[model samples]
Target: MTGAPIVHTASGPVRGSWRDAGTPNASAAYLGIPFAAAPVGELRFAAPVPPEPWTEVRDATSYGATALRRDPGGTLIPEPPIPGDAILNVNVFTPAVDDGAKLPVLVWIHGGGYTEGSPASPWYDGSRFNRDSVVTVSLSYRLGFDGFGYIDGAPHNRGVLDWIAGLEWVQRNIAAFGGDPGRVTIGGQSAGGGAVLTLLSMPAAQHLFHGALALSAALADIPADVAKERGERLAGILEIEPTLAGFRSVSESRILKNQPKAVGGRKGLGLLSGLIDDGLPWGPIVDGELVLRPAADALRDGIGADKPLVLGATDDEFTMVADRAPRALRVVPSTALLRGVLRDRGVRRAYLRANRPQRAKGSAAMVGRFVTDHVFRSLVVRVAEARREADAETWVYALTWVSPTKGWACHCLDVPFWFDGLDRERVSDLAGPNPPQSLADDMHGAAVSFVTGGAPGWPAWRTEPGTARVFGGHPQITTTAYDNTLALL
Candidate 1:
């Protein structure tokens, strides 16, 4: 079991591959193991059903199919394309494939703003975690309209249901992979991070995972009205009713073809084509059914109150947008010019109020800060604050390490460090060569510590120091690093 990478899951036996050829200490990677049935044909837009048990041993040697999604613009991070119908699969990485180990499990939900991304990304390889004695599970769930659309025919939040199904699979079978399901920590970055919070609010998701880590949690919830509008637009584009029957009648190819148009069809927000266009068509919505309330309110009302949690964002989450923005706009924007571009008056006011007399005026940095705080950073703070009020065991952190090459501590910058993926060339491209191994050790260690032991070797937010770990070349614990800006938001 340790050397050959064979383990029996609840469904059947899977043969995985070892990171190193034959080293006993090397991690075993079980790739593309189906946890749920293929959501094709009749199952399209439906809640995931448990995958049928296989009598034969499945080859879990290669990465599985990714969910159907189209990247609107080339992302800074590279994601490889892996094709197939069994997208509702989970990849497992374990140090030992015997029940005697009982290692802690970290189930990762990948982030792509809920529209794109998959567990198949090279950056998501979990062998590094396995090296730390963690049983890491990376899963693929439905994305875009199939995942989050509020259609008339389909139950909302099907993607989330897929996650639940995957977790259930882990609970039933991880023991054979030397994992203790009772010690599972659900974590992800961006949209995946948002899912972590969303699941925390869900009663059905309770007890599925004991602890949570949300990296730069995008806690924004789509209003039911907005979701409905997007759904209607998609339906109209298809020339059919917005119900499940009508949507199911349409081919997945057609759905994927028109998806970008359906998303960009919004009057103002034309999808995430650039840094300026901040809106996305499909995302986690407060459907009043699955998500009864916003995450902060849900936490305030005692949801996930007892769960050990770790949450934080990079210092400059939107700098990528700023850097990529048109030179005329980002290099130096006039106050009036900025206001003219601020389409929504309330946002304009928020930006004006948030910017103080002390800070720099009318520059891309200021604009980036506004977008960063508004979209992600502020929500992390709010959720953390609410969780703190509930007396939940919570530790917060901010990755302030700016890559010497990248210059800005942009969004997704901290991912490779957390995954201990600096060895990967693509990761090194983002993190820069000679990216401090010690820092990767610190951040990766923190995640492993949190997943395994429920505490990341840092003082809780409610403790005397009142600090949040600032991870970098010289990581430190500081109190209220963004308190002043957070107050304005």
Candidate 2:
């Protein structure tokens, strides 16, 4: 209990150090343990393969290399990019080591629009969850073109395969870390949230996890034809054949540099319009194999109907982006801006009528709210509605807490709160000084409750469709949480 704790995993024995040693909240942290081999060389675009076994005790004291080769500057979460090729790893935090405690597990996936994100963020540290008697794990997987891009002769959704490999590792070895693989809950924010929902709807992934939490989920659901087109476009730009051998001929840096160009659309202001119109250019694709259909459609058909789920988005997820062009937006009428995004005249008028409060805030705020509602809030409603007839146990929430620094509820404002990590570094930059610990208690407590039990201290969405736990606001629950978004649908 005092020295570095060692757990004999199925792959090998990993020695982990103690955090807050000699304290009641002390936990064992095993960092950078590989569940799969390095995804370089032959394995780059292939499904994940199991890591080689080791006899020597491997040091699990530091973070491993990230799939993101470089730092993605200006990310809300502090996801520092670590260097090296072995990017398929997991970091586990547990209150007990081989103690037969059988605590519930939370496997978190970081969000970076499916292109960038690191499992090495201090914000994702699992010390808080350990204190609450839940084993926490954050994992790394292939990103960008290497993960999701379609290439001839390559297995589709390699990133998703990596997720399944990681979960399979958990099922095989989590018991050694005092975790119950049977009670595992997978959750994430943004693209990570999308990853959770994608896994939930996947028939291949249903057995790997028992519950799900999706915060501001963004689905790619790229049609097979579209993904193929994008892949061909990328190969054409790189001046290589659109085959596995052609991609392997180019360096990772070359691929990363040119992937954006392949996600072709418009430039400047038209880019925003493109994002709203086209959705994420890269993410899980409906390849008719691994991902049979769009996640919403699958959910509607009763896929993952037996599992409990909690999903929601912040009120103004990306409204802060609008603040950048306040002067120009102020000059243009909100209705004029809506015409560009929502071309249908009747739909535009109905949307404006439903969002009068945002309209009162001026064009910039209105446009920002439109982006948020379009990308995040509407998805929440659609998914909830999809699951209603399926009889899935679902809970919904709205993080209405406005960040004092950002001036809107915004994207990612609820992450640290859900992890109960307000004290983590750089949180003050987003949540500001004097963020309410009481709010963290409420949000994080709900997450813990959901992971430990099936319910999240709120009414299921199916009980009263569209109802949600409204955080950071005066009211506790509301059935009209996504009324404004319903107008757009």
Candidate 3:
């Protein structure tokens, strides 16, 4: 890929380029092309509008702008990779559109706690997948305060709105890239995984994708009352009235800085400063128009009931979250917390009945497991159960493959393996070398199968409750991965 070329977009003609990596006849790859207008300046805090047509051919060869993001060291990915509103962009890697075959489409959403991430992330390289007969598309949506702020006057869930915009772009232009507008599979991990679920619940998103894969998705649906309370608290923190008009005036900096406080219920549980709800005014609203129904509510009534889902979660979920700080373990007195967690996991009697020393080990293990189950594992269960009850076919899996880094099948271990890009980050002293290639090949193959066929290698998850496959050592069937933890909840 040398310079940028203009690609036709629905709104108008936009500029992009064909990337030529040494990967051999690399498909026409376009990166960082905006799908929606940049939400900046006066546009900030508003529902995203499609980007206007460009006058001349703009350079899309170079990665365009990225939303504000704190890199691994908490710097910012957008500082150099491009800049701002360009964040609402999409990257396409296709095997030539005119080839005449309607190919399967896999659109990827990156994960960063809904705070920091971009389409340019290395793990999302679609080269391998594209080479294997699938047209892969990765995109960047708004992130952090820019994407999820709850300003009164501002629309909520800007990130999701951006996602919808990206999907809409895929609908309008993907055919040119050789993708079937009908056979799209939307997928993501962690927060992105949560987004996959959110999309399922969104009425506006129904026609956008045919299948979904949610990997380690931490789906959190805050009640309307709780979310309102959070809006008030965030407003107070910014010294503004909780009202929308008042909060809208607060700087984006204030909103971003205060978001982490909202993550774990700084004000209260349902009050967590997260996804918008009721009428998601900001993103994917359930206003009976855009969303039609809440995602969780939709699953309950079988509203988005038509689409099948493939959902998976790691065994020790929170270990990855905990990995953020090893020293914090000392303060948490994880040992004591472990005992209570085990008791909470329906193993109080069983754990207590064990020898004292054994009880302690059991408690420790259960604590990590409980945290995992609570934050993410439960979501996988709830989504599956809800789908199954609705008579929908959904596949569930529990990944027991432990990483050499001591992080038990923790967060985001799937993407690299799925995209077969592990070697890029393998030498990081912080984590293990790319998961064993066999594991990567197996996972990637499953994803390929799912996109190509309706199966991901393993048997479909049954609605009989608690039936699933554990993709590890022998890929065997298991029931209620954490029955103890479920009873605890």
Could you give candidate 1's per-residue lDDT for residues 399-422 as a string of tens digits? Answer: 888867677787888998899888
Whole-structure CA lDDT of model 2:
0.91
Per-residue lDDT for 1-489 in model 3, tens only? 544444565655555545454456466677777787777766776777888786665556656677654444532122224455456888887764463468999999877666666677666767778877788898887765557655556666667788888898899888767788888999898778878998888766788999898898865454445455656666766787865567557766667677656444322112211221221212233334344555666886775677778888877655444444345442454446555334454455543333243234443444455466556776777777778778877888777777677646655655667777667644233237545778678778888888877678666667357777676645367675545445433
Ranked candidates (TM-score, high to low): 2, 1, 3
Q: List the residue pairs that clash in candidate 1.
A: 153-244
On lDDT, the leading prediction is: 2
Q: Show the colliding residue pairs in model 2.
A: none
Order of candidates by lDDT, top first?
2, 1, 3
Task: Please give the clash total of every predicted structure, in order.
Answer: 1, 0, 6
- Of the two candidates 1 and 2, the one with more favorable TM-score, higher being better, is 2
lDDT of 1 at 348: 63
**237-290 per-residue lDDT for model 2 (tens digits):** 999999999999999999999998998734434445666989888899999999
lDDT-wise, the better of 2 and 3 is: 2
Compute the lDDT of residue 154 as modeled in candidate 2: 98
